[model samples]
Target: MATFTEHYDLIKPGTDDYYDVADFNENMDAIDTQLYQAEQDMAGVSEKIGNPGDEGEDTLFGLLNPGNQPEEKADFYRYSKTEIKKQIQNWKPNLSGSTTFYGKITTFRAEKNGTVYVKWTSSDTANGEFYIYHKAPLSILEAPDQSELGSSIPKGLQQEDFCYYHINYVYSSNKGKPTTFEWVFPVIAGIDYTFMWYASSASSLYLNEFSLGYTDTKEA
Candidate 1:
């Protein structure tokens, strides 16, 4: 009370308590400003972490940028002119739930002809139609279940959720025995990409041999 004059300049014009009245508001305003800034920083980090559809997916972080940009889609699956070959010599079907086919490549190209041809021989099961699908990492490796071909209990070469483009193959009903099948299709906006194959017979399909070749296509 006696020396209130000594601290008057330390106070604000609208209130007597200085810090308790008008000046206190300014202090709170400063704190609120800091809080807002912190929120912005946290949001930036969340954006970087990415929100790939389901959280339980197994992913190579940054491989598929989420919510950022549509991955650069190509008119062709893999670059053309490349020859990729995969060979599975001894594959035990329905052994332990998990089976992986393996092989190698001689040369890889960037662009190719309008069509790609895939060829392979297998002691593949035969009773109904089979499938030749591509393979990639899935959101989760589900317990081996039904293969799309609906063969016997088989492990699915289930790929990640993708917009896949594959042609159909209809074999003769009398087509029995482990044989080889080859077909050529035009490589349109989406085809002839990198993927895998399977046989639709309740038995193990031994991949005797396999090869991938493509014809260079001229841009339309």
Candidate 2:
């Protein structure tokens, strides 16, 4: 059968042409050779540390190591600044349909459709429930065009080229009652989002930790 690459080829190769799609698994030795070559060709760097002699602290490179930072970044959301951290915390949003007396709300992310759904499981049904009102951007319906975007976009966020979203959340417990609360937020355009929730015992609800993320549709 013709392979996926063959189907995608702009100009079909003549039957005589040779093609190899080993998937890098047919020969373990060849795979090992490639790995060795990469290790040999990669670069090495030596840098200074913040507190060089003190074993208590970490080096600059150590801080920048893989998995150490967020995949989606913003000049406005840098962890290095107290103000930035505060801003991100402030921007945290929530979308759960329920609330709690402790003032914490659940969060849900539904990718395909504009509707957001949540599954709440709690032993306390009455006091454990919360109410949520969804708030989202207008374009959660607007498709962001990746083809027209410039290079200024971040790595993970480019997927949102066509996705948009809004946010809303609340958490007000019912006092000693435990129950699951599920709410669906109305959405149009899909988007990358950061959701935050706080416990709302009274009419005023405070913000707590947030969920930050991004999502995109398949390229056309």
Candidate 3:
């Protein structure tokens, strides 16, 4: 008579039965197959679970914080407090332009949607008005119908048909004194904007400096 183990069914010799090499080989073969299958299952799990030091996609270390994740896929990853402070401290002006009243008008446009800053210094003998207008895109306004909308909406308009009057400043400066002015506004990507420096008296209106810049954060 012969008996067997409960789990793997390994052979256990009864008092009357003698040891057999065939039974030993069969048990070893069964154990080898189970070990191979276990190794494969562990490997597949390890790939998804990932190691502690692993970085980037498909790794536990690369997983973003559940509370800090972005709402949109296209949005940038949320940064830590230190990283955000570093970005703000490293903020620099991207674009700049200078022009005098006598020089050609200066225009600015941003490549990305962000906050724009315009700054200038001017010296005047009398009073004058400075204007910064955001030129509207061609698609901003639709063609008007003569039957419904009257003179308020004109037809046959070109791309430069409309502009948003952004900044209107009236200042009185003494002779040989320079006054500085700056404005922060929102800008759309790829739209052109221009500023005008007008003087009530042309005798001594000097635009010393003019600059345009943008930043990702609105605080700029």
Candidate 4:
């Protein structure tokens, strides 16, 4: 009795025999390696397309670290003007325009959307008033951006205006003890800001210890 052999097994040894399991496995591995390399290349292309221009460009996953893990930046930033010991007599004095910069606390930078915190100390005997004004660039103030129309700012502001009141605290409660007030101001990304403080009093309200804080969206 003769047994029947498979048709593929009839091929000569090492003569391009397609039935060789070793050759089949080698080819499969090569194909798999090519597929994997192609996938990697495609992924790199996608990333480049997502973030154009210079390297380390911005992307939808910008909030992630290098390890693909979510990262959170410290939201609180503080700047103190300890040398701001000037006394303001006018009610609407522009501190930013002053030569001393009101103790050099005139400029603050915001890289992303957040809120600004302002704090200062005022010394008044009684019936004195302290004021805080927020100032922006002249370009935005001259035209009054339409986006600022719905803002809570007073309607009395003119077109060529950069000063807007954040708040005013009359020195009636803690007269000689020196009153302190904290104000919160909303901010937008990529905008430079300066704050002006004014005090009105006959006895000369001493202003000092100017400090500013803000919520930041920058990376830690």
Candidate 5:
């Protein structure tokens, strides 16, 4: 008979280690049993340690600011329609898409800290949007009469000189009804800021409501 390899032996016609078919089948069965036991042990260990897949998911608070500070939440303060329209002489859409227009008007509110928000019930405004401008509180006080000129700048949240921001784009057709928008500008502590809004497009829109608020960052 031919001699087989020393390290591993398998049944072959001419090999010295030739074995019966029954014996080969028994060896395979034993190997399978051992493998199954090892798999179970590995699962038990994983269960004790807990799954390591979801390390950073499902969290409420996050470290957003520098020096490991937690992100802040905004505290909302509402404004009345009377107070918002006071800054604007005529709150109608100056730019008209068509000769005839329907829907309510657009209105907004400003905060001392330069935060502004606007709400509307429909998208009748030409572009279904508006512009926000800020003027220094002192400037608004001196030129109370200047409020008639819608182009005149209002108190800015960051810098001076006729700075303005835009919100909402003209939608080809109406999306959903009843929506509110918000914007934030860097503002000084004691210095008050005035916010103004004007129609971006000719579409007529109605101003439903608005608000101003502050945000506080906290550690969780």
Candidate 6:
């Protein structure tokens, strides 16, 4: 008689029993089947766990390191240095204009929170007052009277009329020289702004340049 192993049911010939070819072949076939199935399973797993430097949707590496994703698509991934720099560089004002006391006044609506840069030069006889208003002063098209410059609020307009206001006085000594002055102010998005120069005598200021730039991200 021949006994069998408990787990695999492999035949174990007794010392006194006759040799049996069929039992020997059965054990070999069982071993072969188990090994074939193991090889197939390992092959499927290898496809998912790809080698280094591999990239695509199927591999684990691809899922973890997607490159250069746009703002809308970026969710859990940390932003790269290049991506951060691009965002900061792109934040700039879309509108700009320049005018002198004699030129037409320009008004612009800010597209985003930004800074307004007003650069101008005083004329040869430059002596009077200059003002920057967050909103266009619709009440008066021309500059306010010279006497109003000394008042807390310009004579014609009230304080609430212009939420943001700046005043600068030009002295007669600045006359005939290229006196450059710049006023920088943080402006809110979607608001109209304008600047004007009022000299006791006319044509004393020249608005050489007017521009806008983005404010710092942390401040915004």
**Distance from true position, residue 117, model 1, in Å?**
1.3
Off by over 4 Å in 5: 1-123, 128-130, 136-160, 168-176, 217-220
Which candidate leads the pack in TM-score?
Answer: 3
User: Which of candidates 4 and 6 is the stronger one according to lDDT?
Assistant: 6
Per-residue CA lDDT of candidate 2, range 1-220, in tens?
3332332233333466565444324444555776787676553223344432333326654455333434443221332221111121221222244333322232233354433433333322131223332333333213231112121322233353332332232234443333333333443444333232223233222232222222221110
Q: Write the per-residue lDDT of candidate 6 for residues 149-211, one digit (tens) a residue.
A: 331344444556563664555665465565666455676888765544445443334433333
Q: Is candidate 3 or candidate 5 better by TM-score?
A: 3
Candidate 4 local Cα displacement, residue 7, angstroms: 99
Tens digit per residue, CA lDDT, model 3, 34-141:
899999999988787776444555755455432234444212222111111100111111111211121113455557776666555666554555444465333322
> If the candidates were sorted by their lDDT against the true structure, best first, what order would they fall in?
6, 3, 4, 1, 5, 2
lDDT (CA) for every model shown? 0.40, 0.32, 0.48, 0.43, 0.40, 0.49
lDDT string, candidate 1, 1-220, tens digits: 2122242233234444333455556656766787899999988887666564523323323433332333332223233444554333443344233232221111222253355555555554433233333333341122122222222323333433431444333243334356666655454433224433433333344555555555432221
For residues 1-220, what per-residue lDDT tens digits would candidate 5 score against the true structure?
A: 5343443443234555555787667556666787898999988766555542323323212222122332232222122212232322223434333433322222223334443333334434344544444444454435432133242233332363544555554455354344444444444455434444444334445444543344321111
Residue 191 CA error for candidate 4 (Å)? Answer: 1.9
Return whichever of 2 and 6 wins on lDDT.
Answer: 6
lDDT at residue 44 of model 6 (Cα atoms): 81
Give the total clashing residue pairs for model 2: 43
- Candidates in order, TM-scores: namely 0.33, 0.21, 0.39, 0.36, 0.36, 0.38
Q: Residues 1-220, candidate 4: write the lDDT tens digits.
A: 2222263232234544346576556556666787899999999877755642222335434323233333332132122222222222223223232221111125455556766655666654434332333455454334321121221233333333554453556644345566677665666776666444333332333554555555333321
